[model samples]
Target chain A: MRLSKLIAFAAALLLWSGAARAQQVSVIKFPELQKRLSRQNDTTYVVNFWATWCAPCVKELPAFDQLSTTYAGKKVKVLLVSMDYASQLDKKVKPFVLRRELKSEVVLLNETDPNTYLEKVDPKWSGALPFTMIWNGKKSKRATFEREFTPAELTAEIKKFLL
Target chain B: MKKLLSFFPALLALVLLSNFVDGPAGYQVGDKVTDFKLKNVDGKTVSLADNKAAKGYIVVFTCNTCPYAKAYESRIIELHQKYAPQGYPVVAINPNDPAVAPGDSFADMKARAASKKYPFPYLQDETQQVARTYGATRTPHLYVVTRRGSDFVVSYIGAIDDNSEDAKQVKTRYVEQAMTDILAGKPAATSSTKAIGCTIKWKKA
Candidate 1:
């Protein structure tokens, strides 16, 4: 019984670690992001730009997570794009995501030149953190917010396009 | 009655059009920036007019608590050291509301400036009017102003460089290039750039 309990504890530990490891962030360039943005799909995309060190960005992350859970199996997708330094992917970004147990899909934006990429994302964006973009390819509708959003506000924004 | 009803829709449309026509608030490149008198960390009031020998100013909106501001602190110090002698002194400003971000309070600003041994005047924009006027949305935002007669005209507005994380890997020094071009009586090759940074903590409305 003692041996069985120890084995169960070890198995649980391994599974927990595996779950944490699965949250590793993928580095993506602007072209890939553009392709994702331009893809013809019925799914509405909620792409949030954020960073580990940004206090407001971190504070609003749970809203994104809630959004992901609430919209699961629906036509809405939440993508949390980390603007943290690509060099700190392993040291900072990955660890923070794991620590927070972020449920939303997180990717580290690998593009260096903001002058070009900032316009690519949205012409009006001043490259500020905690910015969010919502778009529906099916309906040909899009919206962008350059500030933090509550879960309800995020839900309402995404719902507008999804409907 | 029918004619009056049709005019109501047009009146509503006019109101909406007026809101859009107002346009985005704050200054753009080539706009004239107003001088501000703000308290420095050294407990003295400083202004652009105080620097009598200065040809221009490198106005940087930075604060004490932001990680991006901390990362660029040394670089900002170096910018002051290099440019102050060249008649373009750096003027650092903390625009974040101390009430919203206590770490950015005046006391904290003094401590950080002292510890870093900052050569430039670290001023606090208590009213945050300067930041709003400059359209500075993030910490460590750079605005290069050139003096024309007595007034200052904004020449460049944006990031310090292409890379804020690694100085060694920086390919283009946007601020430096702009200042050098201005010094040589040439237009800045690159007037504006953007970088990811912490949003300024504004006071609660």
Candidate 2:
């Protein structure tokens, strides 16, 4: 009886963890992202745009994860905004995030038209993956990088805004 | 000291002027594109001028590695088959640097072309000069160039279709629409768009 009870507990634990993992991804519009950015008080947001298909983007994800963990206690928030197709949310994006056990907050940018939304994200973006934008709420200062970042580079960039 | 001060302003003006002369890099709609001699997969040199029968060129910057490129591969083949006889032949150029992206190397391109049985020429931009000139930022980037008198002018620039993931769900055929407009002697309604695909892998500086 005790063994059966323990087995049920283990199954429940597995199911609960699975639910938590699935809840990690949030489908966000550009406006919601803007609002979240504006609401931050003294936090420096390191928002990275990436996709599973983009080789460089995938290669550089570990750096973002390292930054998130290293600066957990700090005012820096690393939000990984996925640019994968909406149709790939379940089939690709979610599975990738869960498999990698990515610690950073992952969200899918749920916009259809890249033409209008690309400009809204950043006029200079040119619709490239692994794009990062660092902004400090207090200073109202922001910087954008269009290329992949190494862990040291990511940390240094975040430090600039934090300092 | 006076001469030096005056020289600084002239130097600054020259610097600004030089940057201006460089002039918003990349081809825009209506800009004339120079013919380039690039090596094709079939081990022969090909150029825009080589296709004398073509009225326009469907110049596409695509690589072997990109998932977006892979998804659009069959559609790209279909586009070539459908349009090649009608004047606009597809000229696919692998723009990614082989060193940076080994999967986009000449051998890989050749193998991919052979396996897919591409009817059109799949060329390699070894220096990526052609892609730089065209300002192709992503894989599967499309540019429709129409012959204008003695020059080839850019008529449309963007994606093949609205949906990159699934072909059946594609609502707007951007490339097809552009070609139709150009063939009918009308201006393309959507001349330029944000190209959504894998960023072209450039060699590290």
Candidate 3:
């Protein structure tokens, strides 16, 4: 009877910790994001640019979420970079990220002047959300779609790089 | 038949090569548009080359799904109602890729037109080439042109107005203000403003 109570207590602790970890969507500094990218060698980095208010961005988010889970055990990392306003980090961004139950690393991109960072992130990007970049240390493949994508379509792209 | 089928791959290759040779994407001011053939809601083809009454045209890259575009829809219609008879007709183009935004499909477009009763031509950019030609960055992005002698000159390229939200708080009616100047044969007071709206969904390069 004592062992059963101990097991239940441990389970509750595990669940609480998991929930806490999932809720933390902090404003990831640019340097930290770059460092994380550089540190992870031999792993494919799928970074998706998105915003909370953008309809298409919200629509296509599930596909990215599915992609992250499907490739979790592999040498793949999915980073969902929210470009929502810095002020919205708490009121909107974190709640949305949490509600979506995002499996990947979620970060509120800490940048103000889009003119400064748009090209820096990817020269081809026109500051469009739903933009995605696939990087594997050596080369970065960038794609900007002004529209939403199905999970299958997103999976196809991932498969190409995985191979 | 077998020989013809075997050459299909080569034929496809040639077509792809020619598409690249059409020169770079985008159009600039002062460019004369000789044609404006497009389908209407009732499935009727309309063209600018046939309209002799038009002194110029207002080509706007807009969509039904975008809130920004929807907000400006009434204003676009007003422009058409106010200026079309005076020789400036507004032409709204849906430049979004249907694959990305399925609601932008022709069927949805027809439904939207019927529902809203748009006064202007809401044409579909089948291959999105026309949108690329204009270098449109977002929905509700406007490009105004007027016929100068025999050519079309860009009068304005930017926002519908200064304010995206709160029409009551509008300070500058950039598009309308430009139209007024163009109608009077005077140079536009402000020729450009910051472009805003959902980004144009260009195909993956």
Candidate 4:
């Protein structure tokens, strides 16, 4: 039992050291997000809608995390917007971020009515989790995907918007 | 030519229609839906045709595993109890592929239905054909359809209420409102709504 305890302690230490700065999650409303999306800028924003409990959404985070590093210096910004209830921000969203050691900007969508936001954001979206939107506010050029992304697929999208 | 100019309106309509064609092409409001047979948790095949007396159906695509579905489970039961007697029955369908989401398997569905003593039919879309035809994208998605001759016309497609997380805090009951409108021999004032939910687990190719 003592040996197992020591190993567990070491494992916890390793996991703790692996995590970078804890992500500061900003809970924002749909109007605020719309304001951000409608900005006039050259920076390409890769925003992903995901939740803590969604299995496929969790599976695709590594891809988004990889892009955060691969384009760390560029004008590209990867934002992970948690579709998990805003009430779960401190309990689920923040802990999941720290545990996964996410290196991208994370935010919680603080809205109760999805009907108001879903259509405003993208008419094509069926309010499915793991939705992604790659856009540049400068040209009003945007591409929305309502599906999970593999690392390779994510990179290809990045090529279209970033490269 | 003047003939080409005359066809401009027709051509423009096609162009506008194509622009609105997004990924999923499911039933739209007022679209006639064919009856479908699916296996219920009671080891019986159930279909819309079975419920001849029902004026409308609140077809819900939900799963046992989804937290969103679980959150609204009790409210779903209440909906059936309230509206079923009013000739609108809740027909819950589990659309998640069992292989992808094990908790949504047939056995688990049966267990859940039995435990809850659901007052409605909890059917399984094992082939997922019905779900694909109806364009169900996520768990706890709803469609309220009213009988029109031999077919059912979609009256509403979307969320059950304004609040998904808290049933008590719900302000607008979309499905109930649709049922009320249909019963009143009028079209639903709020035809469609949307809510964030777990994506249906489709079988991988």
Best by DockQ: 4
True contacts kept of 1: 0.71
**Prediction RMSDs, each to the true structure:** 6.3, 6.4, 8.6, 8.5
Pick by lDDT: 1 or 3, better one: 1
Off by over 4 Å in 1: A1-22, B1-23
- Docking quality tier of candidate 2? acceptable
Residue-wise C-alpha lDDT for candidate 2, range A32-147, written one tens digit per residue: 97776555468878888999988889998988877756877787788888998878899999989989988778899887657657767776676767788888868788888777
Compose the digit string of candidate 2's lDDT tens values, residues B85-156: 989989999999999989998999999999999999999999888988898888888999999876799999
lDDT per residue, candidate 3, B63-179, as tens digits? 877766887788888889988988989988888887777878888899998899988878887777777767677787788878766667677777777555446766778788888
**lDDT head-to-head 2 vs 4, winner:** 4
lDDT of 1 at B90: 92
Error of 4 at B147 (Å): 0.8
Candidate numbers, best TM-score first, in rank order: 4, 1, 2, 3
- Clash pairs for candidate 1: none
For each prediction in turn, the share of the native Cα contacts (below 8 Å between chains A and B) that it retains comes to 0.71, 0.51, 0.11, 0.82
Find the 10 residues in a row with the least total lDDT in model 4 chain B. Answer: B16-25
Q: What lDDT is reached at residue A14 by model 1? A: 95
Q: Once superposed on the true structure, which residue ranges of model 3 sit more than 4 Å away at CA? A: A1-49, A53-56, A59-95, A102-128, A131-163, B1-25, B97-99, B201-205
User: Could you tell me the TM-score of candidate 2?
Assistant: 0.84
Q: What is candidate 1's CA lDDT for residue A118?
A: 89
Against the true structure, what is each candidate's TM-score?
0.87, 0.84, 0.59, 0.88
